[model samples]
Target: MAVEELVGPAPKGWKYKTLGEACKDGGGDIQTGPFGSQLHASDYVPVGVPSIMPQNIGDNRIIEDGIARITPEDARRLSRYLVRRGDIVYSRRGNVERRALVGHHEDGWLCGTGCIRVRLGENGADPRYASYYLGHPVVREWIVRHAHGATMPNLNTSILAACPFLEPPLAEQRAIAHILGTLDDKIELNRKQNETLEAMARALFKAWFVDFEPVRAKMEGRWRRGENLPGLPAHLYDLFPDRLVESELGEIPEGWEVISVDTEFDITMGQSPPGSTYNDIGEGLPFYQGRADFEFRFPKRRVFCTAPTRLAKIGDTLVSVRAPVGDINMALEDCAIGRGVAAVRHKTGSRSYTYHFMSSISDVFARFDAEGTVFGSIGKKDFHSISHIKPPRDLVLTYEKLAANLDDEVEKNEQESRTLAALRDNLLPKLISGELRVKDAEAFLKERGL
Candidate 1:
């Protein structure tokens, strides 16, 4: 297909060239260093210079969260390997070759061994253009073909230097980058907003349940022998009379009770069929793994099986029971989960309340997880031993009312984010291929008022 057919028309004075010809040198320079053993977790205090690793470089993006840091002494030990702003970093030793271009935001970051950092020549190649080109399908295929090693495929400095691109003029490069960056900015905003909302809900839960502020207020009224408080309903009064109860776990509020997880809910482990049983015909049902199934978007890639033993209905909570503890998500459709996950169905009450309660207790379960050097897992026995603070029927009803409203708002924001992500992914390939021009993209954005 012609480029004009996808986008409107190319700008005047634009010249097309191969990426190698556009650069003064054949390709950018790569720097290597000693592995990450020089630093330890104790050496990493709260705030210091970031230490970039292969895991830090996401597919076509940079992840600033869950990063490690080092002290001045550690920095001095690895001084030669520090990366500057606008350096492109790529993973050299992994089955999936992850890559990301550094931005001006990360000016003086220290890089790890698993990545090969690239510095452009004096001709001033656009870093954003290089980033987009590296992420293109053709370039990735080329890297895979040239990758060396049997157990773990890898790319070295030489392979990365030879990766090709369809180079456009500098102005067009900047325009393409700017358009893509704008979409990313929106996605980042949605993520931050959702985090804030989730924090607010958790804070409210802490205030009322953990700190017992509401119970304290009620007790103060009873101690002074005064009338009921203004905000509290009449039935809630005298609910927390001066009393302490002992249980299997420990002392709890007077009226509160303890119960096993199975008593209140029906839980079952998921099963993964053998490789021969797996099919991508899109005929039977959706299949899922642990955390991959819980991504913000609904599962687009699906596997199917005719077996009845591997099915879970919508609204059932899918909890990761293995390696990573308590990664929970509610199913959006009838699906089958791998062995790493378990499905929970609430007994009779509102599933919303159960979901929130499980989320609240997730941290406690994580603590009881069996520790190991390589992998840690939480077994069913440990999960069954978890103690829960079961509130009275009226309080649970109150929690349900408040939580449902907040959850509705969260779901609305999630849906909008999904739509924006789809649009962004659809436009990225076309724009980078020169099949879609900047003017057409701008017009499309204007029509949507974005």
Candidate 2:
């Protein structure tokens, strides 16, 4: 029950401390971002400094996909708001639970509007340890509770400074950080690799089907019309006839069919469960309605349903069928569906093709939504009739042969990310509270080569 009995006299140098005490009189200080009016939305530019916003802080890391940028001049104009390496940025408003540590690559990135930054001292807490400590469940609970604002939850520098931290000796702090950072690094690696793999598959799809690169190659004599290209084998190249053929969907490969989705997918528009049946207790089945419930390539299981009207199986493509329609996610598990969503499975049993097919026609679906609806949405009737290109069966098989392994790896990485994340989450409070010693944590991490 006591520190000594729990983990051997707290491993000699553990202390109960508040962030304010640890950070005060040292370089580890904290502050909120620029005032909203100081950094207007009009100042955003296509390219310049990477400005970290609340949305950029994803799953404990700074994800760059959709980050806004500001001009170098503008960054200098707000130079005092600059975020440096080894700093932790917290969302100042909205989803205050989310935060990200600035790394070397993010050094000098603008802390940006709508966030708070904590600068670690050169001689105080290890930055990674501090960031991880703040993210631990107990600390996060305090953060959420102390957070101010009714509709839009707000976090500020004062709230962050008032939070408690369980401190170990500096060396032990770094060791604990090492253990957690290893897991985080691997998770980040997997996320980037998945993005790369998805891009590769999409490029292949565009070349063969959308752009008809093979057909264009043959027409230009870059590739023999009926023969093979270097990487392509057999009569596969013959599938792309040397000339374009006119179709309702415009120029497509000679033998490919432009087919309606009704013939393409075993489609089911979702039916929402009764409001009384919905809960956050993991009641019966995972539920999703729109993009808000989506994670990268998969749906986030937040709420659950007891009464189900429509459903999806693992790997079925889950699509947003409401306003801002066509954003896609694959079912990570069987889930109860809601009215704003739809699920589809490929009749041919090609999971990779099924998702890619929908993604390739996303613009078409969006356009159709614009034309037929009062709002931007695709009704079940319209979704059922959406037209898509049916690439040659053999070509689809060929693409599958090349890309199925990529999808399988992404799924495996996702599963590992979940497991590693769980491990890290479980260990954080234990290690800090001295219930689990750094040596034991090291053993656990080492066992996994972390």
* lDDT leader: 2
In terms of lDDT, model 2 sits at 0.81
Model 2 lDDT per residue over 12-77, tens place: 567655676677635668888888789899999998998999889986679888899999999999
Q: Give Cα distance to truth, residue 44, candidate 1, Å.
A: 4.0
lDDT of the structure predicted as candidate 1: 0.67
For model 2, the superposed segments whose C-alpha errors exceed 4 Å read: 1-12, 225-227, 279-283, 365-376, 448-450
Give one clash count per candidate, in the order shown: 0, 2
lDDT of 1 by residue, 75-171 (tens): 8888877877777777778744567777777767887767777776556567776676566665676778888888887877666655554656778
* Cα lDDT, model 2, residue 316: 89
Instruction: Note the Cα lDDT for every prediction shown.
Output: 0.67, 0.81
User: Which residue pairs clash in candidate 1?
Assistant: none
